[model samples]
Target: MNQIITFGEVLMRISPRGNKKFIQSNNVEFYFGGTELNVGISIANFGGDVKHISCVSNDFIGDTAISYLRKFDVSTSAIVRSNRPLGVYFLEVGAVMRPSTISYNRSHSSFSEIQPEMVNWEKSLKKGKWFHWTGITPALCKGGKETLLEGLKLARKKGMQVSADPTYRSGLWKYGENPREVLSELVNYSTVFIGGVNEMNELLETDFSYSNEDFIEASKQLMLKYPSIEKVFDKIRTSINSSWHKIRARMWNGKDFKETLDIDITHIIDRIGTGDAFAAGIIHGLQKFDDYKTMEFGAAACAIKHTYLGDINYANEADVISILEGNTSGRLKR
Candidate 1:
């Protein structure tokens, strides 16, 4: 199996039990995850060798977060310790017509305080075949942007594939740096683009519609602008409500364009981390399957994530394959 490297923050997610709001529940459950961490964990669960690099508090919470990654066989040796507390967010899971709400308290967290000199990129990418990152990292702090840029440069020099998911969150970019300029600089080192029309528009400053024809044209323009990006994969989610969703995926590999059938989830257990799961699946499938099959695998992995609760997708390769084979009957294995 090819080894994949993921770089980002590790966050502690606190949520009221089930569908209850904080005001209605005295109890809460905590899980450790971040956008990149979730992808690393999901890829690790799929029998891939994944190492996650991040900074955590030099406290029990950080220790517990490292342990959580270890439980899923994700490597933690690259993780660093800092005096700053671990990042945290409070989640309220909603149902039916209600939507989930989240409040972040990670502005001054350990991961945000990471320095570029703290990590040796040459050693970190020694055995890595792929490197993954999201926009959340660079938006946090200057240190994060510099550190990730260093890693991306090394990964590209090593001839390793790099995947970029430029997830734009308007609320996260308080550091005065233009997201477009920063993301454009970083994404130039990536080989695969893991987002859709909105991401392209954000990076290219173009207003592209959501139509398939427009998506294809936008992808063409994106590849023309960033020649390093060889392929683009997008996950489309059609939500009927907070509890029900339909997942579909499409891709453009410079020459061919393919899309998958929608995989409907009439009941969703957890909506978080589903997109990360899709990214993980695509990264894993690129080595083991064809392009169209890889897109199907990604969509299948995404649909399966809705059946579980928490910030990570617990589905393995076999589980995703089952879904791809149309075995979503949810029957007992026995």
Candidate 2:
């Protein structure tokens, strides 16, 4: 079995139950989530060998996080323990016309202060055939960026396939550096890039008009800048309301462009980790199916994620494949 190694932070998410506002809520729920952790769990749920590497405090909260990962059958041997507090965020779920809100309190978390030498990168990635991370990891802090870079470099050294989601969060990069400059170095070794036009303009400093033709042109320029990239993929959404969305996905493999038909997602349960699910689905599909089929498979994976309640895509391979085959009748499987 091929092993996929993912690197990032595992965070504690506190959310107000129901549609209540944070200010009015007296009760809150705790859930575990992180970009790499979400992807690792998704791949593992599809029966893939996936390992996740991150930093965590040697405390009960960290124990709970590890337990969550173990429940999903993701390997946590690469996790480094320390005394720093765990990264946490509070979520205020919204509805209809209101927008979802998030307030992060993750400054100086264990993972934020992670150093490159803290882990044996070679050992952690020894059997890894695929390595995955997101732009959010680098945006955490300067040390986080360096640690991620070291992992990327080691993955390249061992001839591993690398993938990244250019998750540009405006608030996360507060460490006195240009995001474009920091992210470009990591993108250079990536084989699959999951991003879009605004991201290209922000990270690569390219003036893509964001039209289909210009998207392709931007992709071409991106490929020229980083020949290591094999495919650029993105999921597009047309919002009908805060609760309903018409979503599809597209991909460019440096030669051809592929897109999936828009599927309506009504009554979104949670929109947090859909992109990670898509990335995991594409990675899994690439290993088992053809290139073009991956886009459809990834889109299906993403669509199902919005129906779940948490950060990880709880849907398994059979469920995703059923949806991919156009059996979205939502009927009971008796």
Best model number under TM-score: 1
TM-score of each: 0.99, 0.97
Please estimate how well model 1 matches the true structure, expressed as its whole-model Cα lDDT: 0.94
Runs off by more than 4 Å, candidate 1: none
* Predicted candidate 1 versus true structure: per-residue lDDT over 32-62, tens digit per residue: 8999999999999999999999999999999
Q: What range of 10 consecutive residues in model 1 has the weakest lDDT sum?
A: 118-127
TM-score between candidate 1 and the true structure: 0.99
Choose the strongest candidate by lDDT.
Answer: 1
Query: For candidate 2, lDDT tens digit of each residue in 1-334?
Result: 2899999999999998987888888898888999988999999999999899999988999998999999988999989987998999888888988888888888888898788889789889888999998999999998889999998998988889999887788788998988888888899879998888877777667677857888888888888888999898888878887799877888899789988898788889988898899999989988999878888889999999999888989989999999988887799878
Residue 18, model 2, lDDT: 83
Model 2: residues with Cα > 4 Å off, grouped in runs: none
In order, what lDDT does every prediction score? 0.94, 0.88
Going through the candidates in the order shown, the clash numbers are 0, 0
